[model samples]
Target: MTTRAAGVATPRRAWLGLAVLILPVLLVSMDMSVLYLAMPTITDRLDPSGTQQLWILDIYGFLLAGLLVPMGNLGDRIGRRRIMLAGATVFGLASVLAAFAPNAGVLIAARALMGLGGATLLPSSLALISTLFPNPRARATAIGLWTAFFAGGTALGPIIGGTLLHSFWWGAVFLINIPVLLILLLAGPFVLPEHRESGRGPMDLPSVLMSIGGMLPLVYAIKEIAAHGPAPIPAVAGLAGLGVLVAFVRRQRTLAEPLLDLDLFRRPMFRLAIVSSTVGMMSLAAMSYLVGIWLQSVRGHDALSAALLGLPGAIAVFAVSMIGSRVGRRLGTGRAFVVALTVAAVGNLLLLGVGVDGGVGFYIAASILIGIGDGLAFPLVSELAVASVPPERAGSAVGISETSFELGNGLGLALLGSLAALVFRSGGDFAPTLGETLDDAGSDTGLARAASEAFVSGMHVATIAAAVLLAATAIVAWRTARTQPAAAVGVSAEPVGARH
Candidate 1:
């Protein structure tokens, strides 16, 4: 029996709810990676500008990151379950629109709406786990499983999308979500419990607007700088975004009930966890693009073939997340994450050796290591990041971490993607752009070989940069573990009363 009275409810029914909660995350995570292989198809069909192409990839994350805080807090005050249901509806509707969108602008808008729906879904599911599990160790394990499904979705996206693309059209990926949404809609009310912060003040509408305004501009600046190099417009956008952020921070100080826990940063584990997860996620994001290019651009593989190449890495990631939980429990959670980061660094460094002829075998081997490292590290960091706050504020805590992930994905596309692009252009063996690089190489055996080799050379530099960043993140995590020393793993295991 799991009682609702608050002191660690041990309800058997919560496991069923957990299964239900995994649905939204599984769908959302799949959305992240599924579109990558489909991008080339979209480009051909939509005939978008370079900037528009980036927007189609980025807008979902941008809108989702910008709205997370407001949405998370809203869930806290009104109810997590209600917010989740509303988001599911939005996500389902957005998926249909995105599937049928005729132009770049409409597709971008649809993706942004999906992002909005994601903002509501991701945090609520994670937060609910905080209340459902009573024992610390069990909670940690549960968090690991949640991260596993999330990881699995990203891994499976390519194969699933690839298979669909092989047989059908690009829109088939979006259409697959319809049936999943129906299940969530019907089962959610029966198993998912509702939680709300009763004493919390009304939602801050102005703050919500400010967050979106500030983030949209900042991300625009970053993306433009990547595509066209620095210019006056991007510079102005950057400053304006910074100013808005400052104003938002000040506004939080004045509000009787702030939207976020401004003081959450005071905890060392909390701060480091965000930094660690964001950096790790950034590497993964960069790889997402590079892998697609490697398959389609360099190897001349179709979309399904490209997506299939990622299957091994995806399996490694899902396996690590599922099986590493016990190992993480045995080791201090902080130390486990640090070890995983070190492993990931080693994996990134291996890319330095890849050449034009670097066989699929080489790529697969490197990807497996990278996948295992990320799979092990990400979940531990996420669990720590959210668990640092009080149970009641779980939504806000998850919102902050999830925001970092969204921002990292965007930044990865801009920064690392730009670095690789720059290196590719400077080779002077081919034209400055990928389109011309391929066109100029067409029908000429020597030029095509040179172009392929040049692209790999660019990848070498990007890999070095990624390795250095991962090492730095690992060092930061290591030092924090040395000093802070985790308080306790599992305090007590108490069962609660509830109905099945």
Candidate 2:
């Protein structure tokens, strides 16, 4: 049997590799929200058709979600470093395409390419860090920083996008990704170590096809339902998507090398971590998109002003995440998760105060609380997910968990935002502009007032939903705490490629 080096050093190359890998997270997460703030500008200049507009906005996430699992599995078959470099190169090239696209169709295609690259970048980077940091404590710290930048990207993207749009066209958002990708491409080969299993497993082509087919329809149906009020076309598509999903699951069971290990979910910690992370992400994503509209359409804040208003949340997220490790240790994982959810629930309640009557102080306080709760919850959830799996399977575990968060972010926004729209229609407003929609219904007074009230109502409902999900997660986490010590070492003892 071949043994490997233990207690890997924190070499300069390793640190640089981490930096290079993090660029994708920043790019991906930034793109997720960057477009939200830029939507008004894009709509005005591009004058996109209804479907084209949604495509331009959502294609990145849709493609990213569809490809992540297959891409991760592929990385395991090939060398991770090779995949990362290729992904970085693709990402850079795609950014240029997006930046200069003449029409919405080209922009949508470019975004999809970027998402393809992102799927490769995300899982490969996490795997690289796992290979480089063998020590558990050191790995946790590294992962914490990694996770921080991922979260930070969402917060920072708007700030940067806001600044860019103030001077340049909306395309500047895509332009910004170029330099980051270039940095990764240049630095990756020298800095990042290569990782591949000793023997390559047979590729799961059937699973990949089924997954892509299943995810694409479902995501598209959700986006359509969000926009078009659950029409028959989307309804049928959603049901068909369910059928494809069932087929995918059956295919996975028959595969010699499954793309995703469904059995890992049998582990309690894995279940809780995925659920809680999904809920947290869903809540954050829904709110982030809605709040931008609130700031600009309702609150009458400019893009720059709206971005500035959101700074408190960004700062709070950074600060809280920095201290989360200590808090997790002190409170125990279950207790910490429950506490974080409770705090997030309180933050949501504060968002209820964001009526037309709210002042700057109200927005600041709400943003800070929301940001801090999300910051604290996610890293702990990520830790629990990987710790539940064996070191060798850590990459798969992490990838699955991250994928769940991304799907949840997209799904949550669709469901909650759609529900809000439905509620609005029932309440009587049908104006073309979002602000006017609220105004005619008497839910808001001024332009800013309408935006604030609309957001507050939508956000309140979403938060209540998220809080309910977290409450369930808390129960699961409590059960997980009892099994953690055993599971951590238990998983480590298992050999690679062994089914859970």
Candidate 3:
């Protein structure tokens, strides 16, 4: 009964398939933040050392970021559906293992396995959307929904985790992913279509190795620097990662079948979209991290209470993400970027008025503004990235776009988070994070007050820096939009790969 129009699948089937695909996307994003509220309980139960605890919290993201590109390519050569189903199996089994892990080491290993599965799920699901909805307008809508689910999952993670932790054991966080992923595993084969290049060459093993090597070290370096500030080990690892990436790029140029299609960067719109995605994510992630700390540590709200207060912002993000593409079409993509980023910058500036004593209203209002801006911008970036490439190369293009998101998230924490930490340290000899500072303050009211003031001061500086960065990026987006024609910025139906 299904029909095709200009080779695009029936809308009903495509939309149904999209529903199946988003299951993994939601789970993957949730896993990233779900641990936030559960960490204390996990520590109490597992008796992990500081280093082990860090690994349990971090290893999943590290592996997930590192493997995204290679896995995306793998999906292109094989089949997106095939890889996705396989990944779901891995992810589901790993989640179970993590839930029942007897020790910290086992949990770390299980989390890493989940990351490996996640890498496959993200890009494959996105690329599948490109295949499913070839019409430009439909594709934009699909990506917008994808963006909403992603943002919603991240926002819901702490709230969901806190809710589960109140009644169930700490392991309930990991257990929650099972039923959702199981639905994906069962329904995906029936609903999703298989898509792959007909004559793609075998994957370049060396390129894959180089990518993993470069990305793992680079992400590790960023995380280490963020957590403990600059050290010799992280510096060396970062330099080494850079060198490997340079070599990888050079190797790609020589290969008859490169792992990544480097030529995608030649398109101005593609390049601009990647940069926008990176910077936008960076600013959003930085603000989210700081706000979570500010609510819990400075405002003395419990995890559940703070999450409840932030729910309205989360709702704003989810609501706006659905309508962002329509807004872009009405205002023009360039003007849309300008308006969105400016709104976000204003939100960041509003944080400047927030204080240790009474800024709950300010914080809530600022979070909603920031959420709206991010919701309006992120979907456009994803759509542009996929639309800029040929159908056959959507997977590669999506890989780069998703990689930018991962890197941006890490860099935001490293760079801006580090800046905030420096300002806090300058105020006094204190622990690296506000939580630790308050914990150590004990009954010392004066010490707690000083720590709170210092934390707010640091948050103000970081938000100002974030606002400035967002404003600058918005300016660049404006210029890019003006120079490029409607088609160049992803408005036209023509594939950018054809132009090159």
Task: State the lDDT of candidate 1 residue by residue for 194-299, as single tens digits.
Answer: 9887876788888899988988888788777766689999989988998898899899878866665566666666666677677877787777777677778777
Q: Candidates' lDDT values, in order? A: 0.78, 0.71, 0.80
- Lowest-scoring 10 consecutive residues by lDDT in candidate 3? 484-493
Model 1: runs farther than 4 Å from truth?
1-9, 323-325, 429-436, 439-441, 486-500
lDDT of candidate model 3 versus the reference: 0.80
After superposition, which runs of candidate 2 have C-alpha atoms over 4 Å from their true positions?
A: 1-8, 49-53, 388-392, 427-456, 479-500
- Winner of 1 and 2 under TM-score: 1
| Per-residue lDDT over 1-500 for candidate 3, one digit per residue giving the tens place of the 0 to 100 score | 45555676556888999999899999987887777666656766887764465567567766776778888888988999999999998999999999999999999999999989998999999999988887766777789999889877766777787778767888889999989988998899898999998787888999989988987788678767765778999999999998999999999999877877787787666676677767776776667767777777788676678668778777887899898878877776777787788888898888887889888888888878988988887777777777767777777778788877766665666677667877887888786656666768999989899988998898899899999988998898788668753633375445655653
Cα-based lDDT at residue 337, candidate 1: 67
Point out the worst 10-residue segment of candidate 2 by lDDT.
486-495
- Candidate 1 lowest-lDDT run of ten: 491-500
Deviation in Å, model 1, residue 10 alpha carbon = 3.6
lDDT, residue 369, model 2: 80
